[model samples]
Target: MGVYGRRRCFAVLGLATALAVGALSPAAASTGAGHGAVPAGLLERATVVDLQTAMHARLLTSEQVTRGYLDRIERLNPRLNAVVRVNPDAIAMARRSDAHRRARGARGPLEGIPVLLKENMNTADRQGTTAGATALLGAQPAEDAFLVSRLRAAGAVILGKANQSEWSNFRGSDLVDGWSAVGGQTHNPYVLDRSASGSSSGSAASAAAGLAAVAIGTDTDGSVVYPASATSTVGIRPTLGLVSRTGIVPITSRHDTPGPLARTVTDAALTLWAIQGADPADPDTAAAAGTLPSDPRTVLRRDALRGKRIGLWREGHVGVDADVDRVFDAAVRRLRDLGATVVEGADVPDLGEVTTEHMLPAVLTEFKHDLNAYLGATPGRHPRNLRELIDFYDRHPDGHDHLLFDMADKTDGDLSAPAYRAHREAATGAARRAIDDPLVRHRLDAIVTPTSLPAPVIGRERDSAPFAKTTTHAAAAGYPHITVPAGYAANGLPLGLSFIGTRSSDAHLIGYAYAFEQATNARQTPRYLPTTR
Candidate 1:
């Protein structure tokens, strides 16, 4: 960057920090799961499936449904900032879809569901996708991204795009989890001061807040699961190839996956189906058939968890939040009460074997290639290339298109260097080695762990947030993992337990998750402002 640019960054940050600290300003409402109360209107309203039923019965119009979510975001999102850009045309789009519904029965299982997608995902509509950065503010793809096509085919109302950590948090080190240029920092609903783990921060917050029935998020490492757990919601990270990544903002293709976030497992499972399917454009997803289920996702067998053999792998990087552990313990007992064969053991497949030695260069190279391909093929407005995107950020220092990890990023030397080449091989090797094989050797249906190390800690440093240490294992393995609220901590924050399995075990994992969720009805609506002890 030029000398003047460097000086300006320091100036901007100085002002932003000062503002962030001196704020005790009260808003009319809050949706930050980290520190605010759950909106009553959303909870009292219909669930995701209920929206479908209403549409089918002619009780609600798709346009009306879309308008409702938009209204909710408008009424409540300012306090949480979970939704960065409201789709100004959402109601119009919904009206068009409503015309289809009137002519035919609902087109897909998700018909009329108002769903929020991470801004990184491309859509054919005029909606802009910047990955929560100011750099690509004007970049709206002409054609829908792969998964977006599926969502549209499913008749979902693409409500609005959510905020995420800038560039999926790959821009630099020392990044805050939920700070996005477009949306600002998303506050956790349960505790306002706690971090809203990113880079899918807005997805998690939006789902937990009841702004939408379900929201979609992407994970490179704990991006979805960690944030879902932190915010007391169900978020699933399907096996790597289970969902298409064709038009998503890039991080590492090897670990990136688009998943669903919802208040309940059924809602999440439904959204998952809508997004899954092989995309010829994305070769990685060609193998999706083996990993995803064709079964309808909204159906739940409440007794599915009963009489099942479940392996509890309690040893991971879980920070053992006192409130979280208490919740987990109760959940385990509920499992037993429900007639599940539960085994608690700590022989998780790998810890030291896969991590110490690593390969990341391979992943970064793929990221550049895959991202470039999407950018080139995308029809609408967007950065012509990654290099141009970086340049744009340089020209516009606005937070709207910026999630700053490092001002030094613009100065990083040539990525074409041999050192960069070697780095890719090392990181890929480590990821492949550390993930999957262990689950295979264990021969388990699903491996379970506390989804996160700690309950959301108010004002905790982003560096301390558990993502790689807790989630990268499953991510690297290319396996399916789901998080369900096990119970609430004494502090009233939610604690989550994760269900992970090998690549093709998505169905089994969901079935198991459903069973557990039924056995332990631990999720409770947040009261917005709980009295702190």
Candidate 2:
């Protein structure tokens, strides 16, 4: 099995019923919530823009919103298993934010906002950076990940750590999507017994459940976008070099990136702008020196999709379920209504070769090399390398899966290995061409497809649904890909529409997604349903 099969990206078959429009309205626009009168369900549907506006107008305070999120997490996290640790200093940070705002105006886009970090990110704080592995239970890093530092500098509160798949879902051959030894399974908030579709599982679920203003997730392949699709949130896998990866638990340095998940595209874009830039530590970020915009939010107009050409990518394992196809078809029609030209048959070439021959080998080989480097640099009495980590799991094997770790241990962690270099070059070249060629030939601004099938039942046998082929090509090419809430399945599970672009087109893709989101309003707040029936 390749990355898709190992990660369990398949969804269960269900009835095909499309929802019309799904923006959640405030229960009460004037309700007292410890601060001034605040809108009820503020945490559930409030955007960062909304929160900031409310705070600036003195209708809400930073402390009130922070406490509100804390209360929600306290109530909902037990059932969802999305959070692994709560920052003991989160409320203090929020009060400090209030003080700062009281002295000077708000700091930036994320000022006074609470954000969750995936457990794989090293935060140099009270929480453990375990990557959901108990082997590194007490291990800590010397400093926050580069992006986390940027977030703090922007005056955002470090809310807590969200659980993720152990070792970012590269630990075993038969790994469940959201299962981790340290944090247990993450239940999809839309349907509690369904898969959250991780490595970035908890981040998506928390964003969907309004556990924080937004959450950061690390994507190697489908980790960020896949989970966001399953949870009816927006996820952006930026150009790999756009975000610094220093201090993150690695699957492959070439493909690893931290991205934001939120209930709206504008919020995700704002969070991405705050956390993105060049880093002295991760030299790969140097490639992004001039690629990013002054602000991604400048392109947030509702008519930003007007006159743009979009390629419809429905080839090779993309159209999986009848319901998902119906949802995607409606999304394409909406795009046309919004004045985008949708060109059909924009398939990536040789997808099979990219998945099997190139992507798998490079992922396996680089995981060993990159993870060993990260482990060596991290502080504490834990596994020093992949080999040691495999032994650690061998000693404590309950709920831990390390078959992939064993595979990595057998390989010499040498980047210059003859086959390794060849595979990496071949994979990068082919995947890049797969995305770039389609865009150039179609004269397209972006490629559109169904992000994934709707959320599948947890631990259920894989059905015959064709695998959704959305994230891998963008991941391998180190390009930008964003997934937005397109619609829902009959079971109330969310479906996503993806927009993929060539290298460093993050701003344009975000603009396109934002427009679609505004036109469709397709993301409803989760119902926490026990089952579809």
Candidate 3:
């Protein structure tokens, strides 16, 4: 039998063993203890604009900013397990940034900012690009991801790599969203027993807990937006190809894109602008050339939504949680009060059948093809292909490093298969039509929905009933999706209001999201409570 059959057998046997020993405790499995007291006012919720002003006024050095964040990470990360590794060179890098500002003034928009990267983004630094996998622990790429280089050139200090869902949550069906064997489980900052969501778990949690000024994450589907919603942060999944994917770990080249998660829409917009550009290494980025605005911040007006037609997508006939629905309705009312014309039940063609039949199969084929290409290019002694990765797991069946899910199923079929090709084409076509037809029909500027239900309890394998289905539509259409904090649930959990626009409509989407954010001003910093009572 191949790895799937072996995995089934091992799981059956291991279930008993795991139960006997009891599944790993979140606290006991953590790497270190929480340390340091919380920082003083404004620092916790300070935006990029605030930090820039402080630096320009000589009120704070980059080193001091970096050290403060490092202290926050040291204090909070152990409990949240958000950051995977702290960069040894971070202080030194900040010192260099300080020197540059003193000698030549601010280099660019992101000058002297501290940003954390999702672990999957390759950085040719002291930190490793592990993707939260022990097997690839020491695998460092020869250069930084195109986006990371852009951040460096803009004078942002690279704080370090944040934890991620192992292999971007493609390893198995039973895999927990935010739990990676390499990093344990990342807990929500608001409530320690709740999940932060993943595979962008660390990036979102870090931003929410004030461990970093901003964080970068990659989204295949809901990885970035869902986690941002869970943590009450702003996440922007820009139009695919708007940001280069080269030098980052791959899941599917077609659906994969880097995004920004920050405490405010302005900060997220600034980070998006800094990283977006055409790169020859990734030919898809050619489409984004001249399409994006010169500065997305220019569109951050409180009046941006005035006279715009916004679609309120109520999941059609599907039911959502009563509390979540109540919050979403309030958000729509707020939009109307802000001068946006809200269109209820906008007639978007449903792509549910297409997603059920085609999306997963296409993802499976793309994962095998694209990941092998990425692995082949990397310099490492680790598994070079999906098959080798499965074999590595097989060798450690009973060890702490054993795989939680079988990847062999994803590698089962060849990309050349006619079934796979047909599904891929059908899914892409359906997704585009589903989103585009609605906008054209309704004359809508954007579509709005809840980014997700309140985050689920931690350690649960999946989210409970009433999950949001909107992310698939945007992800498959390769459109821009922005999520801003809407309100808190009765349980004190946060919910997000998503603004999704057609492909290459990132500037408009950001404008709308920023406008709503300015109007609502709903996001609240986490209290880091032990748990929800």
Q: What's the true lDDT of residue 431 in model 3?
A: 85
lDDT to native, each model: 0.68, 0.84, 0.81
lDDT by residue (132-176, candidate 2, tens digit) is 988898687999999999999999999999988877878887778
C-alpha root-mean-square deviation, candidate 1? 12.3
Ranking by lDDT: 2, 3, 1
- lDDT string, candidate 1, 439-499, tens digits: 4554445667777754444335544544335576677767778898877666666678888
- Location of the lowest summed lDDT over 10 successive residues in candidate 3: 1-10
Candidate 3 lDDT over 61-107, as tens digits, reads 67767877998888778899999899999988888887888788787
TM-score of 2: 0.92
**Candidate 1 regions with alpha-carbon error over 4 angstroms:** 1-45, 297-299, 317-319, 349-357, 374-442, 454-459, 463-468, 530-533
Q: TM-score ranking from best to worst?
A: 2, 3, 1
Comparison by TM-score, 1 against 2, better one: 2
Which consecutive 10 residues in model 1 have the weakest lDDT in total?
24-33
Is 1 or 3 the stronger prediction by lDDT? 3
